[model samples]
Target: MDKKVTIYDLAKELNVSPATISRALNDHPSISLNTKKRIVSYAQRSGYRINKFAANLSKQKSNTIGVIVPKLNSYFMSSVLSGIEKVANGHNYNLIISQSLESENKEKLNTQTLYDSGVDALMVSLAFGTENYDHFALFRDQKIPLLFFDRVCHLPNCPTITIDNRKAGADATEHLIQNGCKNILHVGGHLKRNVYTDRFTGFKDALNKYGLEYKPSNFIETNLDAAKIEEIIDHLINSKEKFDGIFFANDAMAVACMQSLLKKGYRIPEDIKIIGFNNNPISEIIQPNLSTINYPGYELGVLAGQSIISHLNGNINIESAESILLKHELIARASSSSTN
Candidate 1:
């Protein structure tokens, strides 16, 4: 095997001090841009890999961030993560990412493992059943700068970043109502989560404001998984009243329900108009297209990353800020259009 190149080798080859190379590698602003680029290029060409353990030992920091999300295989989640990675990488920080598979037990376990691995900070989007947030106590106790996004709860000293899910929900419901969807139904996720609970609140608000009588049978609390499509179909089919509209908490569920409805001989807007959240890419590809809410996932991630970094560097007191709410917009489409 070829010899492993060290920083010293690159410094020797480039005629720069080891300290200069180190500063350049850490992306210190003090290092001249030209010199930093030269050092980094030589280091990469010479196969000099960073020894994070040694670096962490010297600086007393891992220069790494940990992230936990409900699922990784989603457009919205992936977009958010991409934004986080972009910001973290620009600042010379590595990210350790894990998924909870929407399980609270798995989320707790992942938290423990990430903490044990010595992450400098942690960002989490809570799991469906993570009502007990005690697992995050270790991070708080250690002052590790914990943050929550999307699905969250109140924990002292921890900052949260999310869109106004309640308003977004109300907008979706109101849009359907404006399109003449009288008997509206709302398919939401577990109310234990703030995201779902808040949206459900907004849904009820729109109904109340529009003078539509809310019916118990018009609401269904689901796991919001795509696999729940069959159950949704069964529920819609068995409903005593002929429902004219639905507002799904996420795009995947809405798309699934729409497909099932089309197969069952239902005209999308004529028989049942629909709206969904997240504005997922697949929403436009579906037959009638989906009307939905545009939640800025990537921007939310970027803000969350910048917030943690700011907190760690003393640039901002994120804990004092408590929460950051991003903007959301409603996108109208053929699925909810009465004229289409």
Candidate 2:
């Protein structure tokens, strides 16, 4: 086996002290820019990788942030991850991203693993099944920076990043009402999640503003699994009550139900106008483009990265930091167009 290169080897070859080589490689201000470039160039050519584990031991920091999301396959989650990676990389921080797969136990396990691995900070978008947040107590007790986005919960001194879901939800519902939808149906995910519950609340807010009675029969709460589109379609198709509009909690399920309804000879925006949340890429690709709430998932991720990094660097006190709420917009499309 070939021997791996180290800082001592670089210092021996470069005729400098190990401390000087370390400072140069780390781009310390005391090191000249020319020295830094020369050391960095030589280190790259010699395949001298930084020993992060040893470095973290000295600094008492992993230089790695832990992130937990419900699922990784969705466009919104992917976009958020991309943004987080971009920021984390620019700051010389690595991300340990894990998906809970919507299971509370899995989320708890991931939390424990990241904590055991000594992550500098933790960021989470809570899972649908996460009813209890006791798993995060270790981080809080240790004064580790913890931030939440998207599907968030109330935890003491933990800053959060998210759009105003309730307002966005109200905007989506109001758009439908303005377009002449009198009897509207709302399809949401698990109410345990703030994202789904807040959006549902917004839906009702709009309904009440226009004097439309809230009907329990008009609401459907599920896991929002696209594979189970049959259940949603069956309810919509066989409902005894009439519905002229629908507000879906997510773009994937909305697109799935829209396609299934189209196959059943339902004309979108003509027979039933629809609006979904998230504004995912598939929203535009659907036959009739889906009207949706622009949740800005990527922006949320970027802000989350910046906030946590700032806390870790002591530039901002996480203990005193307030939760960040990003702006959201309502997008109108063919799916919710008014026939009039």
Candidate 3:
């Protein structure tokens, strides 16, 4: 018997994308006739057989859900995923997860791959560079339930679960302001993302509410990766304003920056009060415990999973679903409060 050949083998031989091969083999109109003919000829010669189980998937409910995240290894994201997995597994549903590595093109590719895999529903946490959302139109067109969590975006009927970031940001800043910090700095990620944008907005709102002046240099936007803590340190050291306090967007960056500042002989909560978001475990482990917002990542994930599953089971209409906002609280720790 001849070995069973797959589309990957065909794509490798034809020097085309797997998507193009799949399209050509399916006689999709978008593929040029020449390309289709070439693919068909090769498939026939090599006895390539499409997986019948996958081919028949649309007719039969696969009981499978797909998820796309910016990155897979974050402490906060892992907690969210744990909640999602617990709910999904309890309901006997399977999850197909992919990471975009924070790239727009990779996110698009993952969307296509998940759609082609016949997922009944899809969940996504947007990538940093995903300005275009057209890749998700197919799911909406096919009446598939789509849900967004954490780093979410607007997608017409798709529901979203997240904290009130603007409020959370404001609270953090106001707390710092109340603690006697006059000149404060916000270390954040790209403003293109809602999480970062909302946090920045909240920070500004707090400053304005307390009659503090806002300067262009007050906000320093970076990739927010921990490895680049030196850049933050440099910005802090080289700046003319001499920031009296700092609010970091995430705990990882906040913790790393705190360590760097301590090593550089800066006093925490005295010289430069600091706080971060997400309440990562490291916040407590550090010498001066990090103050942060309890973002409820795990609860957010459980709610997101349940919401999507509810829509899938016809328990609710996704089109009418409203965005769910989880409550966030300020955790006053040694790093931020002067009293601590």
Candidate 4:
């Protein structure tokens, strides 16, 4: 009575084999419906609890997927996690999620911990400070399915899921230019990450295409922290050339800077049209709705989950796996609309 109730105890009590109990519990199709119902009913009545560790040991599969993200506070990350959870749960796989808090050391530790925990597969969104990726080689060496989403890096045999950030960036910049924006300024994050770098590239390309001169002063490589909005506002206020349009790498920074610029008597659209990447919910809630690139976070997560699952089930060969690039859209709103 004191010990934990297991399938073996339930099997002996119900006069069935342990395999039948497991099959019934897992809803294996080979077991008859009536037999499954009976075994499940009796197991519930007997307080039987599945020992996943033991089952995993016998099957050589943990039936668990590990996920690592930069931070959990963003709406985009939450949506991605939700999509992944939906797909993983539908496949009867459990998730072990961890956040890196944007620290390289923390990300390394989390990766090692998840690998050591015997996860069947691993998914990651790299941290900003993660310059070294040697830590992830453990999963590659072990032949465990490894996937990257959002902020990804190239690793042999590891598939990546992400939107076309460069195109999205160009789309956002072009939208602003179409709305009559010239002398635009780009606010971005660390250029070490592809997302920010690609967006910046797209911005510059759009500027070049529009016959607008690209100047080093027109771009700001920031940390993208909302708390540092004042520094950006000061930069804008003190610039020799007044920017007619602004494009931010992410919505949070755009929204924060918009509020501050407004407080400083700058008018939206009329004074300086603004466009941001990642159509986060806050983009709509802000006073003058923000124009942004619609980065499909949920869809990216779903595809990542499906790809990993397919690889794990042997339905797809990981060695020949191709990286997935989701489409992005430019959403025009009051903040960047010429009509406003």
Candidate 5:
């Protein structure tokens, strides 16, 4: 097996002291530019790689950030991740990403692993079933910068970034009401999550503003699993009151509900109007384009990354538990057209 090249080899070949080589590699201001260039060129030619572990120990920084998400298969999540990676890479930082697969246990395990791996910072979008936040204590105890986006919780001194889910939800529901939907049903996810819970609050507020009676049967809380489409369909059909509009928490569920409604001989907008969140690609590809909120996931990710990096660089003091709300817009489409 071939031995890895080191700074010692570069120093020997360049006939310079190891201290001079180290200073040059680190770009110390005392070292002349020409000498630094020469050492860098020689190191490159010799295939010398700096030991990051030793550097991290010396500087007390790992130069790596940890990110945990619920899952990696969704288009929206992937888009956000791409934006985060772009920003992190531009700042010469490495990202260690993991998926929690919607389990709190898995999330806890991943958090511990990332901590042990010596990540300088951490970012998270909470898993579906994460109720206990004890796993994050290590990062807090060590004073590591921790940030949350999308699905977030209130943690002390940790900044969170997300759209105002309540306002967006109210806007979507109001749009349905404006389209002449008398009996609107809301299809949402677990209320334990801030996104869904706040959205539900907005849904009820809209109904109250319109002088409509808020009924318990008007809300259907699910995991937004496509496999539960049949159950949602049955629930809709079994409702005593006819549903003329639906506001889904996500585009995936909205698309699934649209398909099931069509299969049941109901025409979109003509018979029932629909709106969803996330503005996912499937929203446009469906037979009747789905009306949804443009959540700006990529922009959210970029902003989150920039905020954490700024905090890490001591450019900003993000000690308060502040929430950064991004703007959201309603995109009208065939699914919720008034003319239909």
Candidate 6:
């Protein structure tokens, strides 16, 4: 391999001391602007790379923010990650992202690895089965800024960003009722998760407000797997009281449900109306466009990035801010609208 360019090489080439090169590269105020510019240009042209590990160890700052998510393949989660990368890169920070694959054990391991890697901050969206958050204590004990978005858990001093799930859920159910859907079924994810649980609470609250009877058969909890769509279809087909509407926790499940319903000769919004959360792109692509709550995953990520960076810069006291709730809106489409 060719000889790797180093600070010493650049210093020798520029006829400056190694200390001067180091200071200039770091953008120290003591170095003259002209000298710093020259050093930077030369370093760039020479393909010089700084050993960030050594520098991070010496300065005790990694300039890297760690992010943990349940999965990377989802449209909404990936969009959120893209937004985070945009803000972090603009601010000269790097993101180290890892997936938990909905496994709490893997999530714990990733948390420990991120901490060991000396990430300056941590952002997490909990795994599906992550009931225990003890792995996050290392960061808390060390006083590193930790932020949670979407699938969040309340850890003392950690800032969390999410929409008012209860309100959104209520809105979705109420919309269905307004469109003359009395016998509605809510397909949901794990109830252990606050997002789904809060949504289910809203679902019940709306039913109670409208004086509609809450039936045990009205709520179907699943992992939202597409493969299990047949089971839901079977339930819908065999139900004594036909469900006129459906409210799903996530767009993926809603889309799967819609497809299954269509195959069974149910006309969307004509026979049954449907609404889902997280205005994912698929919501638009489906035959009868799905009406959904616009969850704004990208904006959530940007806000999370800004909040953590602000905390790191000492410009904002994150501890004083307990929860940051983003606005959610109901998007009317062919699936849930009567007149559309």
Top candidate by TM-score: 5
Clash pairs for candidate 1: none
**Best of the two (1, 5) by TM-score:** 5
Tens digits of lDDT, candidate 3, 243-324: 9889999999999999999998988978889999999999999879999999987898899889988998899976796799
Model 6 misplacement above 4 A? 9-17, 32-47
lDDT (C-alpha) at residue 149 in model 5: 93
Sorted by TM-score (best first), the order is 5, 6, 4, 2, 1, 3
Q: Which candidate achieves the best lDDT against the true structure?
A: 2
Per-residue error for 183 in candidate 2, Å, reads 1.1
Q: Which stretches of candidate 5 lie over 4 Å from their true place?
A: none
Task: Show the lowest summed lDDT stretch of 10 residues, model 5.
Answer: 1-10
CA lDDT, every prediction? 0.91, 0.92, 0.91, 0.90, 0.91, 0.91
Off by over 4 Å in 1: 1-50
Could you tell me which 10 consecutive residues in candidate 6 have the lowest summed lDDT?
Answer: 313-322
TM-score of the candidate numbered 1? 0.87
Write the residue-wise lDDT of candidate 4 on 188-226 in tens digits: 998888888989999988998999999998999999998
Q: Over the stretch 1-340, how does candidate 1's per-residue lDDT look in tens digits?
A: 1887777888889998989999999899999999999988888877788877887788779989999999998899999999999999988889999999999999999999999989999999999988798999999888888999999888998888999999999999999999998898899999999999999999999999999988888799999988869998888889787899999999999999999899889998888899999999999999899999999889988998898888888887755856999999999999999854
**Cα RMSD (Å) per model?**
3.9, 2.8, 11.1, 2.5, 1.5, 2.2
For residues 1-340, write the lDDT of model 6, one tens digit per residue.
1688788899999999989999999899999999999999999998899877778988999999999999999888998998899889888889999999999999999999999999999999998899898999999999999999988888899999999999999999999998989999999888888899989999998999999999999999988887788888888889897999999998988999899888878899899999999999999999899999999989988988888888888898856756899999999898988743
- In the range 169-241, model 2's lDDT, one tens digit per residue, is 9999999999999999999999999989999999999999999999897799999988898998888878987
RMSD of 1: 3.9
Model 4 per-residue lDDT at 70: 90
Q: Is candidate 2 or candidate 4 better by lDDT?
A: 2
**Any idea what lDDT model 6 has?**
0.91
